[model samples]
Target: MGLLFLTIFLTDFFGYTDALLRFDRVRRKVWMFVGTRSPIELDWDRLTPVSQGITPANSNVNTFRSVLLVDLDAEGDVKFDGKYPRIASIGQTSLNEQQAISQYEYVRQFMELGPTHLPSCETYLEHRTVFRDIVRFFGFLDLARNIDWRRPGETGGGLLVLASILCMLLGWAFLPFDLATYIAYRCNRVPKWPAKIEAYAKDGGEMTTPVGAASGRMRIVLKEVPFILLWVGCAFAVYAWVASWFIK
Candidate 1:
């Protein structure tokens, strides 16, 4: 069952559907599609002098080091072209960036939005990202493995030590790290994309509720609460384990 769950989780983690940025030459419209639904549509005229740029990935993959996009405006303002401003990559990730870059070149070659310039974002990536969570989990497991189980007099006592280490790491290190990085990301991305839109743009937000924003927030809570609760359980385990040891 554990293996089955890991298998399923891995599938979902790595799985991607068809995401396309399509241009309707006849209609002069750009449609951004995820699977069958067109999430965003922009008239070709809405974007101009398409600009190509790479910014540190604030919300997406981390390995790429940067998220590349095509900007329609000279300033590459997200507020101005809030529509489908970003072009789709041929594949995904840095390799995708190469393909996306080529695609950008291809689009700019014929469509002629305007002058082309390479732009970079001036902010840090988000902290509560899936990638970060995965990293954190594996990091803790690694830490757990390296723990000196014999140091605290017993293997069980070492569990308490492990828990304290993790709790301290979460409370002291990760908390501040998340805050600082998020602040930087927000400050840099405000002009590019508003806080409100940014909040709703991810899996964190849900569209099913009458209050779409509220639903999205709930989704984040649901995804996040488990991690929190897991840590809390570990903390309790640590306390109980230590207390039992002392009692004896």
Candidate 2:
């Protein structure tokens, strides 16, 4: 049992850390692509380039394309031409300047409307906050609250606690079965008893009536059996260790 605990502690600790690092790296890449300092300030304008090409139909009329010009720098500057020239200002109302303005306006609107109808900064921040919250919640739910046998603080402190507990459990017991059940629980596989009760209450009907009651009762056995096995294994291991010492 001691050996099992040790094994479980090591594997779970390292595996969880590895997974977290991988997630962090992917998140960073996503932020980088979106032109945000963190996941919190994504500005679409900074990420996407303004349009410079003119439509085939508008090619004949230089003024027509010029009329579509947009002022990106807010100084009424930054003009575009057929060559897509990057210039300082859109001076003098000409066909080229108009075209540049049009392109800028088009790109600006596109950025503004994309990504949940939020500005670059707001969108990025919202997404980051949501992502962080979800990950944190699940980490707590899976690693902190749900244990097969051991207590919460049995594992090391900090982020290692979850990993350590996981390792210890896996090393000392038949972890595959326990792990499957844990997964199911996290996925909310339990039947709809709560929904049924709420419906009855709303209708002024018998709120005590069971809805999906049979399914919930049946799943309890599957949910609890692993914890029992874990406890029994741990106890037997402790007894054997003490017995060995006496023999020696």
Candidate 3:
């Protein structure tokens, strides 16, 4: 069970580094790369943005997804090189049509008007650490997003508040998986862009490092240490109690 858990986390951690699409607004081009294949370069004008949606066999609600179809061969038909298409699934998937459009608009606006006048993006986790990796694996960021600290008490008063509390209490159940993810992340490496793509990106100007937010290490120590220690202590106690039955 432990090995299987570690394998799952490792696969997920490394899967994200296998393929990437680099959109260069400055050069008005997009680079499609997968593994060791020669990267496909497409002009921004040739790429068509299409919104797609699907209803799963078991589900009733439609889940919307967006993609940019790039015409590799200006003649209108998609040509495959050996296996994969030249470019595929270029945009973020969303829950609904509005969200899909909003995601696209965010990219479009950034492409057209630079980074100014847009809602600030979440501050990137500049460097990876065990705590940050664990936070990501357990979806702490998602929980934080749902709570909305900026407008406290605005997400309803009674039931919603109770639900959030319950959600947090249940979140600790994934401690084993989160710890496995940290191990996988510690061994994983970030994917490097191809030399050609790197050169192209550096053509106009060097890419700047993203601004990072406070890591909240101090806050975690002060507010969360006791809870974590308590959880670990309880887990060990339960293990010992269970093992004692076998000993008898």
Candidate 4:
């Protein structure tokens, strides 16, 4: 069962990489690169944006998604200059309508008004290193980066702060799962853009610079080490107790 799940997980992860949509804000165009097919190009303005709520049958669970569709025929097939894919779906699904709209708006703003008009966000590029993977796997870096010992009362009082700490630290109980996630991420293939797309990306735009760890964050991470170790030990103890029943 575990091997079956691993296969499914890898398939789902890599299968999505077979195709990709590339947006060129400077050229005001959208490019679709499907499996072994020639690249399809379309004017950004001609595309229709749709935001929808999706729900599976007999389930209350619903998700919101956004897609950019273009040049549809009577049968709802996509065509570009009469030679392209029959249909294509662009953009990712979100948890809510607002989130779905936000995803669309993010692309729209960039394509319509350039990258300068887009919302600002912190960006980082992590090299594929074992140390980086391990820290990220256990969320040690995030916990370290976001921790503010001096301003514990910023969000709420001491009780609320304590509750947040407990909740975040609870993730440590899933050490095995985190390890599996780390391994998958390390082994996952990183997508490389086509030479044409790469050149286009560098044509003319204000690129976002990747930032590194903030000053003194390593010190903060040191403080969190003991807590993570304690939780890991506890998790192992519980695991050993549970396995003893079947082991012998």
Please state every model's RMSD to the true fold in angstroms. Answer: 17.3, 23.6, 5.2, 4.8
Candidate 3 global CA lDDT score: 0.60
Residue-level lDDT of model 1, residues 75-149, one tens digit each, is: 755532244345433334453445545655556544444212423223322212332332243344334434454
- What is candidate 4's CA lDDT for residue 72? 62
How many Å off is the CA of 141 in candidate 3? 8.7
Residue pairs with backbone overlap in model 3: none
lDDT of 4: 0.59
lDDT of each: 0.44, 0.35, 0.60, 0.59
Choose 2 or 4, whichever is better by lDDT. Answer: 4
Q: What tens-digit string does per-residue lDDT give for candidate 2 at 1-248?
A: 99997776555432221111001111121111111111122223223333343556746654422322232445546433333422222112344655567544543443344323322321111101121132222233233333444555554235445554553444334344444334433333222223433343354334242322321111123433443445446645766786999999
Candidate 4 local lDDT, 201-248, one digit each (tens): 888755645344232213334655655555556666777777999999
In candidate 2 the C-alpha lDDT for residue 139 amounts to: 37
- After superposing candidate 4 on the true structure, give the runs of residues whose Cα lies further than 4 Å from its correct spot: 1-7, 13-19, 35-38, 74-76, 80-91, 125-145, 152-173, 210-220
Error of 1 at 65 (Å): 7.3
Worst 10 residues of 4 by lDDT: 210-219
